[model samples]
Target: MEQIIANGLYLGAQYALIALGLTLIFSLMNVLNFAHGQMYVFGGFVTYTVVVQLGLPFVVGLFASALALAVMGAAIEKFLFAPVVRRSKRDESTMLLAAGVAFFLDAVILLFFGEKQRGVPKVVNGVFNWDMRIIMPYDRILIGVLAVLLIVAFIVFMNYSRSGRAMRALAQDRTAAQLMGVDVSRYSMLGFALGAMLAGLVGGLLVTITGVNLGMGGPTSIKAFLMIMIGGAGVISGAIAGGFILGMMESVGLTVLSAYGDITYLAIFASLMVFLAVRPQGLMGKPWG
Candidate 1:
């Protein structure tokens, strides 16, 4: 149980970061970015390239990943999503565009990063074993701590910073925000960029532990969607709650059901379905129209 809890907390911290990005984008633009997972993979590859291929420090690679993804996200919002949202009457148009962008990103990743799994050297050595009950890698501990710190920073920013306040305003009520003198376009783009940056940062951090692969994008995106749904689609706190909930479920299922083959996920999905049937709006979300 100690091991399970430790593993769950560690995984939850990182997973929450991923969900935060997705939820932020959804809250701001009402656009589900299918390409988010691809962006994460791209960040991992960027980090791998910088650290492994270029012999740069891990810190440099991490920042590079964040910066690159931020630029890409902002450009995508400016050129693709914004225009589509402006011109289209139906919401499905943005969804289709998101799907198309996901495919395009997949192709781009395959072409540039190839199909191999890429990993980095351990950022820290040794394991922390406490009373032979909880054993965790030092690198994992560091990653978890960093993830938590980043999350705290993000919360602070959203609650305190000018851009963050603007983004939150936009998310709450677009028309009201605009009427209050908020530049909707600029803030929307900024919010999207920040979300993408978080994804890239988490990817870079996790590369040392899970490695980077071209095929993980779809699964990652699916997991992100699940987190958002579990917590409530457009709520930040809900996203965090959903991420930790999923992480705990994953940890327990993986550990307890190790002897049961792949039934772990089957059980999980079934449970989630039942839960959603009971509370469709999630723990903190408003009911859908």
Candidate 2:
């Protein structure tokens, strides 16, 4: 049970990291970026190519993966999202555009990578043994530590940095932010890039733990969506809360009913429904005024 709880916390950390990025983008742009998952996949591929294929150092590969995805995120914001913002269309249009990008990217990846599950080489190796009875991978511990560091960095950036303040302003009210000379479009692009970079970092971390493949993106996106929904659309802290809760539920569910493992989704959906019934605006979300 202790080991299970540790594993759950590790998984929750990853989910929280991914969900944080998604939640930030959704809050600022009001768009569920379907292509975000592809960026995650791309990050893994970047690291794989750099370290595994090209024989580069792990840290180099990691940074390269993050930088590449950050550039892609910037491009996505500028070319795809910026046009939609310029047209001032409904929120649905942005979702549609994201879906279209998702489909296109998936097809491209399928054509190139085919269907293969490949694992990233572990950067750190060991096992933590407690009382000479329980053992767990040090890599998972590293993941949890990294997640905490990233979350702290995100919070600090959002609260202290100029660009972060602009992002917060835009998230609250775009028109008002623009009137205050915040350069809304620029800030939006920055937010998207930041979000994508975080996703890429998570992707790199995930590859070390779970391997890489094309199909993983879709399921990850679904999980991220659930996190966002359960966390509340616009709340940063909500993402972490929802992710930990969902991760614990999933881990506990799997342990208790390993044979009926597929029922986790039903449990998640029920929880969401219950949460909505009681707190329509989500745990941290502001009530409709």
- The lDDT, on a scale of 0 to 1, for candidate 2 is 0.84
Q: What is the lDDT of residue 67 in candidate 1?
A: 98
TM-score of each: 0.98, 0.95
Residue 190 displacement (Å), model 1: 0.3
Model 2 lDDT at residue 83: 89
What TM-score does candidate 2 reach? 0.95
lDDT of 1 at 47: 98
In order, the Cα lDDT scores of the candidates are 0.93, 0.84
Residue 160 CA displacement from its true place in model 2, Å: 0.8
Model 2: per-residue Cα lDDT at residue 289: 9
For 76-101, candidate 2 gives per-residue lDDT tens digits of 98999888867964768888899898
